[model samples]
Target: MTTQHLQNRVDPWGQLRTVASRGTRMGNRGILHNDANQVVRPWKHKRWVTCMLEFKQIKRPKPFSRGNYSELFFLDEATAFAAGHRPCGDCQKARHLDFKEKWLAANVDAQLRSAISMDDVDKVLHAERCVPGGGKTTFAATLGELPKGTMFEFAEAAFLVSAAGYLPWSFDGYGPAKRIDGATAVTVLTPASIVRAFEQGFVALVHASAGLDDPAAVASAQKNPS
Candidate 1:
């Protein structure tokens, strides 16, 4: 329960604060990482969890949506999946065993290798990591909202959203929305972009299913597809 309780906690951002150094400076998890502090501190009631795949620490922008869902918690919790954490045994034992058996990652903000491969990252995260579980988090923009096929060149290959669709993305351990104006102009495809994410699989580092907020939510969705 300590870790659950730890979720609500906030951390102040300062030059010394880890998040601040990493450029998680703006609107961090609905909180700010302040500077000029003698010590680092955490926020209150940080009980939400990360249930997606994340290999590296990406930098996210402000004005995003984490989204309310049937089962997942927070996908934009900045530090949620960067290191690693397994599922709760009481609610997710079988998957938890599988997770532990594969890779035991607990997100640590300190400098170190987070994941060897994207699959290595997935082992600790649930497959259903989505934005702002239940309106708690979100990506403000949409694919149609962005210039279709616009390219954002970070360190990796150029990323383009399919046909002006909106999808969630995280860079340098932070998450944000990436939009493309047209399908033909880009190579990036997403569940939201192609609208057939089930078949495509992990276009981004993380994503969530329709039903993944909690046990009750998951159970309810299972009974009712709508």
Candidate 2:
């Protein structure tokens, strides 16, 4: 047999689509599909950290993708589901858009059947995005930028909160709840830059009071420093 024969016998790993190391299995039934092979493909997922399914309608698809890089792949639907890749909007745009619209419709239907309020639906959406700042980044200069706060304090706060998985949301209560800006409401919240500011301030307060030989003065300074 020629080299071609050996190559033919081997599976084409080249055809495999690239994806992130981590992925969560979507429980939506539409994610499973069969084509007479008894195999099923999951509906949709992300190509990377950013892209998310936004506005959509069932009748037409407008998938969000990054063009050719967002190529769709699946030896079959089952394998595609197994590998956990979803239709890309920019590349595989149509299919993904269709999936979103259908998902929203089904979600609304299920909620109605259960007599859940639209508010409940909003909560579900909120939980899904895992927003720490009311789903609006004050830092957004572009579509995908991080959210910043009025004091730029929120931005610093978010950098740490995002690492910890605790979105503290903004305090504005009007525009958007920013995790960073919200935390700053303490008047002395932690930030990457100011993580030790309060602690150091306390120590300085203590030292100054010790010089003055007055514990009461130290405590006062610690509580309300000039």
Global lDDT scores for all candidate models = 0.26, 0.24
Cα error, residue 65 of model 1, in Å, equals: 24
Which residue runs does candidate 2 get wrong by more than 4 Å? 1-73, 108-226
TM-score winner among the candidates? Answer: 1
- The deviation in Å at residue 210 for candidate 1 is 11
Over 58-155, each residue of candidate 2 has an lDDT whose tens digit, in order, gives: 23221111221222221221112212222344533554554344434545455554465333433443333223422221222121122221112233
Prediction 1 global C-alpha lDDT: 0.26
- Top candidate when judged by lDDT against the true structure: 1
The clash number for model 1 is 68
The weakest ten consecutive residues by lDDT in model 2 span: 4-13
